[model samples]
Target: MSDVTVPPAPEGLPYVSVVVPVHNDTARLRLCLQALAAQDYPADRFEVWVVDNNSDDDPRPALPEDERFQLLRERRRGSYAARNRALPHARGEVFAFTDSDCLPHPDWLSSGVRALLREPRPDAVGGAIRIFFDHGTVPTSGPEHFEAINEFRQRKYVEEWSFAATANLFVDAPVLSRLGGFDATLQSGGDLDFGTRLGRAGGRLIYDDDTVVDHPARSTWRELGRKTVRVANGIADRSAHLGRRDALARAVNEGSGAVTIWLKVWRRNEPAPRRAVEKVRYAAAFAYVRLLRTGVHLGRFTRGR
Candidate 1:
C-alpha cells in the first residue's frame, strides 16, 4: 500500500482510544459504532476513531455528524496501512483496536482497559472473542462452528505463548511507537508479526479472559473464499520476509490441516454438504496459491535485483 509512517501523538491523551478500521461495509460498520456508543465506560473518558480505508462509498451520509467520533480516510489498500493513518491522531494512553464488523460487550472497554492497567507495564493485552451469528438463519451451536469459534477460548494465557489479534488487543503508545507500529507491508499477519516482535523485545503480552468481543464468522461462500485467499497471501508474504524455508512448510501443513478438518465435517455430518464441499474446494485452491506464491516470493528474494 504505502510506506509505514507514524505521526506525533495528539497533544493531550484520553483514558482510552478505540480505533475501528472500516472499508466499504457501512451496515456492519454502523452496528460496530453503535456497540461502541453503548459502552459502559464514561463517554467523556474515551474517544472513537474510525479509519475509512479508501472506501468508494461516501461514508459521511452514514455517519452522524458528531464531535465524539472522528472519521479519517486513507487512500491505502490494507487495513494495517489505514491503522498507521489513524495512529498519529490517537490521544489515549492505551489504544484499543477492533475491526468494523466486530461487536463489543458493554463492559468490553472497561474490562480491557483494566486488564492493561492492572499489569506491570504490559506491552499489550488481548481479550476473548465469541462469534455472533443471526439466529434461525444459521445455527451458532453447530459443532463445527462452535469449535472454530471456541478455538481461541481454549488457548492457554501463558506468557510464553502470548499472541494477540488486533481485533481484540489493546496496546500502550510506548510499545506501539517502539515497535514502529504495525508493518504496513503485511496483508493479514501484521498482528502476529507485531506480537512476535514485541515478545522478542521483552514486551509483556497478556491475555485477559474477562474482556470479550463478538466477532462474526463469514456467512457466505464468497466471503469465505476471499478471506482464505487473503490469509494464504499473508502466509506467503510472511515466509518471504523471514527468509526461512520452514516457514512455507509450516504454512502448508497448517493450511492442509484446516482442509482435512473441514473434509471430515463435510463427509461425516454437515447438513449443507454442497456448500461445505465448495468451501473446502476454495480453501484447497487458496492453499495451492500460497504454495505457488511462496516459490515465486523465494525466487524474488534470492535474486534481490
Candidate 2:
C-alpha cells in the first residue's frame, strides 16, 4: 500500500460526516473504526457515525470511545435504511460513506473533501477500492478469487453508468438531502439507483482515483451466491418499478450482456505458464458467478410475473 499524507485542512474547510452502517460484523467493524481513528485529517473537522442496522450483536463496544465517533441504532433491516436514519442527524456539509468491513486509507477523507471542493464541484464523488485476500498471494477459495477481481468497479460505474458504490462515495449534503437519500427498500443497488437519480436530476457524479479503501474478498461460494442474488433482486426491483415492458427489455439486455461477458472470460489467455492453473481457477469462478447471477435474475423475473 502506498503511504498517504493528509495535510492540514485550509481555513473554512467544510466539516465532513463519515457514515458507516453495520450488521453483525464486530471484528471487521473494529478494524474499520481503528483506521478511521488514524486518519490524518483534522480530527475536529470530521465525525464518524456508525449506524447499527439491527445487528444481533451489539456494535457499540467495538467502536472507539471518542466524542467524534457516535453510534446510532436503526431498527430497520437494511443498510440504506440505517443510513437514512442517520442522514438527518449528520452535521456536515459533506457526507462520506463507506462499509463497516472496509479499511480506508488515512487520506481517504481528505481526498474526498478536496474533490468535493474543486472548481467544477460534482454532486457526488466515488473512490477506488482494492481487494485483499486473507491467504497471501493466491486466493484461498474460488469465491475469494472471484471477489478479488470483481468486488468494486468504481471507475466503470461512475464513467459509464453515472453511479458509484456506497462503499467509498462522498456526496454534498444538500444534494443528498434533495435527492431524499437512498431507496430504503433496496438491499443492494441503492447506491446505483441514487446515483442514477442524481444524474437524471442534473447532478454530476465524479470518480476520484485517489481516495482508496481495502475490502476483504468473500471467502465462500455460499456467501458470494447470496450477495449475487441480493444484487440481482435489487436490479430486478428497479426494473419492475418501470412496468412489464421495461422489465422485459431489461431482461433481454442483461441476458445478452451476460453472454458476452462469459465469452470474454472463456477466451482470456494467461501468458505466464506458472500462473496457468490460477487463470483456469479464475475463469471457472467467473463462469460460476455469472451462471448463478443469471439464475437469480430469472428467479426474480418469475416472481415478478
Candidate 3:
C-alpha cells in the first residue's frame, strides 16, 4: 500500500481506538505501551485503551503520562471478556486489537487505518504477524523453530479461515457493535467467531500485508503446550456449540493434522543432526498437545447440550 500522508487536519484522519488486553504481563505491557506511544499515526487521532485483565501486578505504572492512553481494569478471566469491557468506552470509528505481548510497528496504526479507508473499503482488516525470538538469540530450540514457522499466519487465517488473531486485527467500530463485540465466554478463538460472524453478515474483510506487528514466538514446550490446550479447547468449545456432528468432525480433523507435523519439519532446510532432533521434538510436542486436545474434546462431548 502506498503511503497516504496524513493531512494536516486531525479531523480528516481516522479516529482509532486501539484496544489491548493484558494479564500478569506488566514487563511486556510496558513495551507494548511504549510502541503505541511511538506510533506514526497522529497522537490526537488515536486513543489506546489498555485493559488490565485482572493482573496480579499493577500495570498502572506502565501507563504513559499522556491522557491518550487510558488505563482500565476488568475482573474477567478471559481476554475476550476483558476486551468486551472496553467496548462501551471506545471512542474511535475503528477499533484495533493487539495483545500486550506484541510490539506493533510504528506504522501499524497508519497502515491499518489507511487500508480501512481505501476506495473499496473493507469492514475489517487483518494484518501481518511477524514472529521474533527473545533477545535476538540464535533460533536454537525445536519448539521455537516450529512455532516461528507455524504461528500467527494472519493473512492465511483471514483468507482461508475467515478470522485473524486479536494479536493484530483492525475492525470498524460499527461492525463490531453490530456483531455485539467479541464472545466473552470463550477462553480462546473469539476472533474466529467474530470474523466468521462478520463475513456471514456480509461485511467485507481484507488482508493488508504492510500492516504488521511483531509477536514473540513460543520457545518452550511449556509455553507452546499451554497454547495448544487453549487452541484445542477454543476450537472444540466453538464447535461443540455447533452440535455433536460438527464437534466430532473437528476433533477428527485436528487428530488427523498430526501427520502434517512431520511435513513442517521435513520441508525446512536445515542440517541433518539438527533437523532429526527437531523432528523428534516437534513430534513429541504435537502428540502431547493432541492428547490435551483430545481430553478437552471428550469433556466437551460428555457435557453436550
Candidate 4:
C-alpha cells in the first residue's frame, strides 16, 4: 500500500474512454450506465462505450440518450471480443474498463486519470473492486458469504500476479493498441493474460486503491458453482498450449491447493456464535466450488487426451 499523494486532475485532463461489456445483464447495465453518467469527471472529457455482447435481451434501449454515451453491438459472444469491437471507435487517450454489473465510484475516472498522469507514471493501472449484495438485500446465503470473502482480489492480482481484472482496469490507448487487445478466444482469464502480456512487453501495471467499483456478489450456490466452472474452463483453455503432462501436473497442484485452503479456513478464528456458523457455511461453499473447479479441469484434460 504505497501512500502516494495524487494531485487533483487539471481542467484540461486527457480524454478518457470508458468501455463496458454487457450480455443479458440489462438491469445491472442500466445501473452501471447511470453511475457513469453521474461521474464527477468532466463529461466533455470522458466518453462511455457500452458494447452489447450478443444478448438476447437488447441493452441498447436502456442506454442513456446523452451524447457522452454510445451503444455499440458486438455479435461476438465473448466480452473480450466485444471490447475489441469497441476499441477502434474510442476517441480517448486513456482507456478504462469495467463490466456491466459493476458500479464505478463517482471519482473513479478522475482518480485513474490523475494516477496515470503522475510522475513516473505507470503504463497501466488496476483499480479496487468491492463486492456488495444485491440492492435492498443482505448476505444471507452461504454462496453470498463465500463471494464476499473471495471475489475479485484486484490488489493481489496487480501486486502478486502482475495482472488486473477488467472489472476495474485502465491502460493507455497506445499501449493497448500496441498489445493488439485481449484474446477474444478466452472466455475467462483474458484479463490476466492481457496484463501478463503488457508486463512482458516492458509495460508497468500498478494498483491504485483510489479508483473503485462495486460488484454484485453471487447470491446463490448455483451461481457460485457456475462461475467456478467457467474459471476452471478458462484455466484449462490457457493450458491447452502446454504439454499434457504439465497440464495434468498443474491440475493436481490446484486440486491439492484447494484442500489446503479448506483446511486453513476450518482453522480460522470466528469470534461470535453467528459468525462461527457463517464461517462453516463459507467453508462448505468454498470446498464445493473448489472441488467443482478441479473436476472440470480434470475433465478438460481427459477430453484433450
> How many times do residue backbones clash in model 3?
0
Candidate 4: regions farther than 4 A off: 1-10, 135-138, 254-262, 269-274
Residue lDDT tens for model 3, 1-305: 11233234545777788999999999999999999999999887888999988888999988899999998788878999998888888778789999999999999999999999997989999999988886485445666766765678898898999888899889988788889999999999898888889989999888999999998888888988888888888777667668766666656666665666556546646322255776677666665666667667766766772
Tens-place lDDT digits, model 2, residues 191-244 = 988988998899999999999999888888788878877887777776766665
Model 2: runs farther than 4 Å from truth? 1-10, 137-140, 241-274
Which ranges of candidate 1 are over 4 A from the true structure?
A: 1-14, 136-161, 241-305
Write model 1 residue lDDT over 1-305, tens digit each, in one string: 12333333353323677888888888888888888888988776777889899887765655545577889988878899888887788777678988888888899988887888773757788888776555543434333343243234513533445678788888887788888889887778787788889889998888888888887766554565466557656866666555555554554565465546445545545423245544454445434444544554444445541
The number of residue pairs in model 4 that clash at the backbone is 0
Q: Which pairs clash in the backbone of model 1?
A: none
Per lDDT, the best of the predicted structures is 4
> What Cα-based lDDT does every candidate model obtain?
0.69, 0.81, 0.82, 0.84
lDDT of 4 by residue, 96-126 (tens): 9999999999999999988787779898999
In order of lDDT, best first, we have: 4, 3, 2, 1
How do all models score by TM-score?
0.75, 0.87, 0.88, 0.90
Q: How many collisions between residues are there in candidate 1?
A: 0
lDDT of 1 at 275: 59
User: For model 2, what is the alpha-carbon lDDT of residue 5?
Assistant: 24
